[model samples]
Target chain A: MEVVDEGSDGRVARVSLLRTPLFEAHRAAGARLVEFAGWEMPVQYEGIMAEHAMVRERAGLFDVSHMGQVEVRGPRALERLQWVTANDVSLLADGRAQYSLLLAPDGGIVDDIIIYRQQADRFLVCVNASNREADVAHMREHCAGADLVDRSDEFALLALQGPRATEVLGELTDTELSEVSSFAFVDATVAGVSCLAARTGYTGEDGWELYCSAASGPALWAAILDAGRDQGVGPAGLGARDTLRLEAALPLYGHELSLEVQPFEARLGWVVKLDKGDSIASAALRQARERGPERKLVGIEVPKGGIARQDHALLDGDRRIGTVTSGTRSPSLGKAIGLGYVEPQLSRVGSEIAVEIRGRKVPARVVALPFYRRPD
Target chain B: MEFPDDLKYSKEHEWVLVEENVATIGISAFAEHQLGDVVFVELPATGDEVAKDEAMGVVESVKAVSDVYSPVSGEVVEVNDDLPENTELVNDDPYGDGWMVKIEMTDPTDLDDLMDCEEYQKFCAETSG
Candidate 1:
């Protein structure tokens, strides 16, 4: 690699570690560090492909402490959350988490979040690290009687994902994960660390997300890692995290789902509840849903030769049709896979398109969502 | 850390093993380590002509894509066809089966301007720090 000297300013202030308690442990395990969302996080430890393969075949642990967690409590919590998020919170049962979107008045997505109803008067919302402050402010502004509190500093989040994740996590916690269905959470303890363990993950695998205090995070991580040593619980990084989520066809905050892109255009209509009473952006969502999105998100697969990349022009012969939003050479599929916005007519599966790769148009076909799916 | 004393190095991290008019090119071990598990390689055509320091090809890892710079002006001769099917060879055996291309050098004198193994190693050490 060409090492360019983008010289530092030399102002040696105390560089904050946007760290979980496992920060030092990760460094000790030989993780290559990179800056991500204002935190110095590991991009990969062993290698991307190795870690990715491990997760697919066995299990993997991911430090997702960089994600923001906020608690909304009081009698009006559910009502206030319904006003801010696109999904109806009244439908969510206690200990259940629902994926929803916070929208601007124009029906564009502010941030896609997961709202976990902890109790009748309390709910926890997990948001993107970069958009945490904005999400908090947005919720606070819209909330009338509910108390909005940012608990990101008090808690650390860890995702144990893969097929063997249940076996690994089951060894540590007393609670039976089999009793908890997908998207459901339970308050439990692992190695004496008070944790809220949920059966949810971003990797499209069977996994559990553990939220605990900052001081006890490292101990919990170590205990799980130790328990899962024989099960091949590799520590995954942001590199595999991106590829795995992309292969699963999950919409990322800044990519497929963005402030300028409506939920309908992003193919997240399943999460938007239109008939659940009037709320902010509900009218706009209804209008968008009725008319149908002008542009729709579609999965693209390049059969041969070139890999389609982000910003690559999508073409129908000579006519430029759309642009690729997220693209990568899928390690699992062994082909170039991408997600892009195309005209609704061209978004059908099996529809042929072309992607201009290095000035030459390469053949691509619109494929089904999720290039890879884990076996349930 | 291993640099062959007989090879010439470029600032872009490509190492050239020159034999008469033909030069074999591959990224150095240091380069492969930094790039981390090369997932894709865009090799040039066999007949394509490239200029000194021009974009020879592209190498993609899981994280980012980097442009591979041509170390010297030459006519494209033989590209490593195995790379597309097995890009991880660049990470495993970067200087052997992982060699990207073999180019017929138009000007052999250009080799003199490139860094030697000792100088290149020192350059890498200084730059990484």
Candidate 2:
């Protein structure tokens, strides 16, 4: 497999882009296709704002089949996973999922992953699209003596996310989705296709992600869209997906998690189980825990006006402090918000700062993460 | 896609409405359509002087930023103050409510070089292809 490098700046190389199974569906829906993580994916269908609003108010369907999946099965699967990944795999109960990370030997992040414990000795690891090849190589090197299979090409993934996601999905599947709590999974049939239904999503909304055979993708997609036609279910692309995740403060791979960034620095320290017996980068993470991270990631807002974008320099009275990692004009809040890393001391909430945009300083303030949250 | 017959257009996709010495300017519908969705706009002050074919303002969409060039040289007499908060006007009604600026023309002869609606419609088709 050819491994393409998508730089930290988010620029794509003009190579032959791969297509998902639902590429024709996106084109039929009038989606604007853009190359993302080496795949020709839909960036937007109707518009970013309208699709984002639809997902928040009703339901949205996303074709995330480009993401890579790995299966580890054997009597020693748990031991091998515990040795390679940062989190304690033993804590993951059967039919439950966990958000964890694959770490380098020096505590740098390889990729942020979600592990589904399908059985006592079976696991399904979902990895980022851009890091699929590298993650497989890394896993094979460390996770020896176990049957590790790269099942990325065999499965198609769809994320149905929003307030009415369950209601819409419930109509098509007899999985009793409501009983599958957050971060849980069920192996059942959806739309007459056998699949794994997981109640998890990156949009910070209550939703379920379905994984089915590649040949079953188009059929299931059509059925869900038909079932969700009345619930305001719209075909959403990556553009709305990005803005929604940004509002939720969920980090993307290249933007928030990178080889040079540690979990603590990215405000993802919860996934790093230092006490979880000898795993990859445990020693380095222990030392970093002792010394404390010098820099910290923070959520920032330009309450007055102006949108800050990636690579925009942040300033403290002309002294350069950090660079914005992710930013967008929030469709939900009707304000500009972003995420960046800066000196730990400067990351305090209410601390005033400035973002330099096109040689002009835009006043900003540090705010708490997750710029948007679903009200109970 | 929309070239208003009442306005003259620049090659850079800006539309100009010349009435006496005052020239009202905004982007063409083709420009707005190519720009997806407008989320923010940055404009110059009312008194700022601007030269024709130069960058006078910026229109930012959800994905990218584009410069709005001046169609004719002039001193800025007025700017659309509501554009900062409601940038969608550029996408909704580019010819009317979305006018970016009104200029006190420094050279009315500059209007002679601009394309009329018929010529601009052909130009848009050729350029887009």
Which candidate comes out best when scored by lDDT?
2
TM-scores of all predicted structures:
0.95, 0.93
Candidate 2 clashing pairs? Answer: B1-B30
TM-score of 2: 0.93
* Per-residue lDDT of candidate 2, residues A190-210 (tens digit): 889888999999887899889
In candidate 2, position B70 carries an lDDT of: 93
| TM-score winner | 1
The 10 consecutive residues of candidate 1 chain B with the worst lDDT sum are B60-69
Worst 10 residues of 2 chain B by lDDT: B57-66
Please report, in order, the local distance difference test score of every candidate based on alpha carbons.
0.89, 0.91
DockQ of every model listed?
Answer: 0.67, 0.71
